[model samples]
Target: MPDLALDIAFAWATLLLFGGGLLLLRARDAMHRILALDVLVSIVVAQLTILSYSRDVSYYIDAALALALLSFTATLVVARYVTRGRPF
Candidate 1:
């Protein structure tokens, strides 16, 4: 029963990930693109976390953490570049 629930959740997450990618591609403005990219990253992290929980694997959790950090740094850099015309 619990496995079925996890599978359903995973399916929903996958759909959300796909939608986020589409939004990222279709965004008209730099800021909108950045927001969509952030959403995509967040969905990826959520999928990784769900995979870790379903498989009882510690490495997936670690990878998710690393991905989250990288996404945060990237978002900050992009936002700075968009606002100031340069990221330092």
Candidate 2:
């Protein structure tokens, strides 16, 4: 059923978020940790978007946009820190 598939998707997304968190903890290098952190954030955003669709809530969409902006800034800052140079 379509509902079952949606539920499965949600479960899978949660697993992905958990796995990313573990990766972030286990990752040794700064770059790898940053990538894992980004993946975790992306998974959370995906979950929020899916919930928004299911509930027909416009507020979650706004939350997704805010997450995107903050994640982008975080990535940039982490990249600069990891590379020790400006990203151009």
Candidate 3:
């Protein structure tokens, strides 16, 4: 079973995820989409952390950390690609 408050937070995060996806799709500028993507990733990390707390499991935290790092790296690559036409 999950903690109620954390579960509510998770639900809110899911809602934000949907909202972020909509924002990303609605955004016309490349930079605006990138910003929306970052916000989405941050919200996902928060959700994962909440899941870990609610479940009393340590593995989700590890997954969340990995996700955060991956998101950071991916964002950097995408930003670079946007600016340079190549990820490298």
List the global CA lDDT of all models. 0.93, 0.88, 0.90
Which candidate ranks first by lDDT, i.e. highest? 1
Tens-digit per-residue lDDT, 1-88, candidate 2: 8678778889999999888988999999989988998898899889988888878898998999899899999899879977986555
Write model 1 residue lDDT over 48-84, tens digit each, in one string: 9889999999999999999999999999999999999
Against the true structure, candidate 3 has what lDDT? 0.90
Q: Report how far residue 83 has shifted in candidate 1, in Å.
A: 0.6
- lDDT ranking from best candidate downward: 1, 3, 2
Quote the RMSD, in angstroms, for model 1.
0.8
Model 1 misplaced regions, further than 4 Å = none
Q: Which ten residues in a row have the lowest lDDT in candidate 1?
A: 41-50
Please tell me which model should have the higher lDDT, number 1 or number 3: 1
Alpha-carbon TM-score of each model against the true structure:
0.95, 0.89, 0.85
Estimate, for each residue in 1-88, the C-alpha lDDT of model 3 and write its tens digit: 4467777888899999999999999999787888899899899899889888877899999998999999899899989999999999
Output the worst ten-in-a-row residue range by lDDT, candidate 3: 1-10
Q: TM-score: which candidate is best?
A: 1
RMSD of each: 0.8, 1.8, 2.2
Residue pairs with backbone atoms closer than 3 Å in model 3 (clashes): none
